[model samples]
Target: MVDARGLSCPMPVLMTQKAMKSKEDYYEVLVDNKTPCENVTRFAESQGYKVAVEEKNGEYLLKISK
Candidate 1:
């Protein structure tokens, strides 16, 4: 899991990017705000990942997979 909670836009996306370099089949990205969630979603999808977002208590969980 990429615990990006409390992080801002590019940091979250950048962290996710670094994780994705491992070439895994799945990733769980956690962010506390919508902007990071949305940015991560966009970046992941652009890389051919399927992103599914779940929200609870204002936190966003981005489930990214091939």
Candidate 2:
């Protein structure tokens, strides 16, 4: 899991990108706000990942999978 909950834009996406280097079948990204969730979803989808979102305690969890 990529814990990007307190992070801002680009950083979350960038970190997720770095994690993607491992080429796993699934990814979990945690962001505390909506923007990062949307941004990450966009970037992941652009990279051919299917993004599913879940929210809890004001935090967004992005599940990215191939």
Question: What is the TM-score of each predicted model, taking all chains together?
Answer: 0.98, 0.96
Q: In angstroms, how far off is 52's CA in candidate 2?
A: 0.5
Quote model 2's TM-score: 0.96
Give per-residue CA lDDT, model 2, range 11-30, as digits (tens): 99999999999999899999
Candidate 2 Cα errors over 4 Å, as ranges: none
* lDDT score at residue 47, model 1, on the 0-100 scale: 98
Cα deviation of 2 in candidate 2 (Å)? 0.1
- Worst lDDT window (10 residues) for model 2? 33-42
Model 1 score (lDDT):
0.96
Candidate 1 lDDT by residue in tens digits, 12-32:
999999999999999999999
Model 2, residue 65: displacement in angstroms?
Answer: 0.6
Which pairs of residues collide in model 1? none
